[model samples]
Target: MSSSKAGSSLLDGSGGIQPISEPKAGPRYIYYRIYTKQGALESNNPIYSNDRFISRIVSRSVAPPHTAACLKKHIFRIEKFELSTKCTLYSSLSDQAPVEDSARLALRGISGPGVSEIDPVVLVVDVSDAKKRSKVTSVEAKDLVEWSPTRRYVYYRVYDEAGEISSKTAFDDTDSCLGRVGTLCISPPYTALSLKYCIMGAEGVSPDRVCNLFEDEGGENTMKDGDTVALLSDNYPGVSKEEPLAIVYALQKDPVNPSEQSNFTKKLIVTVYGTWGDYDHTWHTTKAGEIFHTDGILLKKPYVTDSEFACYAAINSSGKKAFIHQVYSSFG
Candidate 1:
């Protein structure tokens, strides 16, 4: 008859959700509290409405925020749009499973009301009737692209996948062609290289989720870093002038302040490339300390819906998830 037990009955019967991770035992000592806001207006002081981390009150109609769309997208902020860096982080408990996340991860990157749209809209969701509130109307995440004291534009490429985009073999083999360019407009530029590969899903419903490259395409081994492939939607821009399988363009983000800069991305697409399928990508993160992701394993095309690489790490475990995407310089 404790609070967790009582709250458990109301929301999905799971009341004891822990924070992403516990504080580690080390010299870096700093204590902080987490506060959640339902209808905009966040206060600097952490607000625990019920006033307790260990409450038994169930999530009465309260819904959680989408993970990736919130914090991952705003990995960096800058003063200029075109001169900005965009990023997304994904991890899965298993290469063959869903991403892991935590309570803090759930509340990672939330901006004020109408202001949410101006944000990149990364971890997005339709959470209505969220916890004690009636009729919660839609939620989108935003990250602050603040400028550091330095004038350098912020950029991150911690999770770049290096390989064929897909291997489903559904597109007319003719469409499988792509090119690889490295080190475009950036300072201290070198060969920021990661092989790019792409393939389409099989031509049918439930076509093995697109990431099951070799198995779906009847190959003994999975496609490797240098192989070229195509997907069902690879023909939008014509066939591959570079490789065997066709390729799709990577997702693009407008300068939060386009008036300032005009940078863009060219990574190949993992989902059905190019049409309106871009919005389908979403993410989930794990509690802190859970290994962010294993190193050196790039999931070129791993049968994921919407191409949003999903990452899952256990709270406090390193290398929990196993996906990697590298960053490099490219030329037009």
Candidate 2:
């Protein structure tokens, strides 16, 4: 993979892609390539052997930042190769990005049907980088972006429940706020751990499966610090690769079914890991049957007028069953 392809000056020995030499070792970069064997775009990234892994195939200017993306994954692969050279990169829209985000949000205390979440790392905005000529756009909960706080950047889900994209403030608290909100971390290749509402989530509405969104809008706060965010369904993340994290979701009791019964209610819990911010985080259910966490506690939480009282549940750090199942208990 490294040797120049014979007879081809531009390519290496096997006629594979080649990296232009850096006489001075420019800024540093990581390259990803796409070798199409067939079909439309792929569902997974490609694999490259140690001998075939082209670590040297990249430009120095934007190398380091780009390589950082593959940090969690060992291989960025042949398809990712283009990512190395391409200045602009979009996330895998289908499943990879959603599952990752769903996992992040699920662990953060946000779960239930139709909840499309995202990693907070991608929400980051570094005002310090204003000089880098980077334009800031409110990242979608659906976009494939990551965050690095050490680099003074963060990925935030800034949109409102009404489907309004978040606007930014020049205030310095942006950094500290993200940090206090658990949206920022100090790890070396540090990244944000935030979640967003997944717009393209499961559509199966089971009668026995209780979901509290529009009816439970802006209510319920059961998340605490040090807990996980689960991206799952009661069947917790069905078709989410059927992975363990894919099977995590908040367990709703009481109104487990039969919406006609006024005594039925909804709650939130973590069935997955690293989907939301943390257990200490508070949450509210929207009219859309989606759950969200917030640092700003609501004065008088929303409620269902029906006789059915709802409660949210989650496995605490100590594995205790915690929930705000009763409206009266919640107020107290």
Candidate 3:
């Protein structure tokens, strides 16, 4: 009957008062915060403190072995939310490109330890409606053309300063006039500069050397670096196996003296094939069926194709100077 408290007897059996030991460390976890939005993804400063926040997901994989598709499934399983066909996953609110289903989360820089609340992976589930709107806001507001995602091949030939075609079979086969440099796979939104870099890599040409790209071997149509493959294909639709895009190696030379401006007398006229709205103030809005006249005085040199616009200064019909973006107009 001298049974003091059973709990006290158990404690005393171990020692006077053995300190409670901490539990062993558990598996590290990675955390991701998800949100659902109903509009186009913003490029910057997206609202995060809103009620759109869905839930946080915990994962044991530090490197995040989950692919985007797997994460989508996990989100659906945990949240019990059904996603539409238009729904896409973005790494952040500002991500322009949707995360591919096969892309791993770790490869997209979305992995971290869940020790603290800081620096958790943020993902946006873009649930924008894909149905076309019934109402018309404005003619200019409507998107006339969209960037295509279909992959296409571009045939090209490289030429030396002497106009001799390169015999390198790095691409496909070769013909007499145009030796097949190679077939470059071009998807929409691909720039001429990017295609040029690909061609240079295949040809083993030094990047420092100036290379001129032309739609034809005659060099009548100059392909600016800022020009998209879509625009080039639209302008020159006949690019095929029989006729390859020409690439000429330009030799570095002294800049033309300002006193030598008298020799530059070529007047180039541009026609707008499609309506171009002025999003950026650098150029004026142009109508679809209007002719744009140029004074031939290139305030900015057109040869600098690496520039964002690849446009030169020209006098409009009203005698006012304007910077015409090359993408919106076709040279006549």
lDDT of 1: 0.23
Best by TM-score: 3
Model 2 TM-score relative to the real fold: 0.20
Give the per-residue lDDT digits (tens) of candidate 1, residues 1-332.
78768787565556755446755432211111111111111212212332211111111112345343333222211111111222222221011121343323333222221122111112111112122223221222222232222121111111113434422332336433222111111101010111121112112112112232221212344433223222212331122322222232323333132122222122211221121112112122222122222222333434233344432211112211123222211112
lDDT of each: 0.23, 0.24, 0.45
Ranking of all candidate structures by their lDDT, best first: 3, 2, 1
What TM-score, computed on C-alpha atoms, does each candidate reach? Answer: 0.17, 0.20, 0.32
| Tens-digit lDDT string for candidate 2 (90-144) | 2211122222321321111133211222222221112112123322324333443
Among the numbered candidates, top lDDT falls to 3
Per-residue accuracy of model 3 over 1-332 as CA lDDT, tens digit each: 33555555677674356569976444443434443221122112111232122224455422256677776666544443444423356554223345787887643223332232232334444222223212222323132323233334456666878866653543444464344322222211234654565555456664435677787667788877656565334343225655567888876465433234453333445555321111122344344545555534434433323335456454444333346666555555
Q: Ranking under TM-score, best-scoring first?
A: 3, 2, 1
Better of 1 and 3 by TM-score: 3
RMSD of each: 23.7, 21.1, 21.4
Distance from true location, Cα of 58 in model 2, Å: 3.7
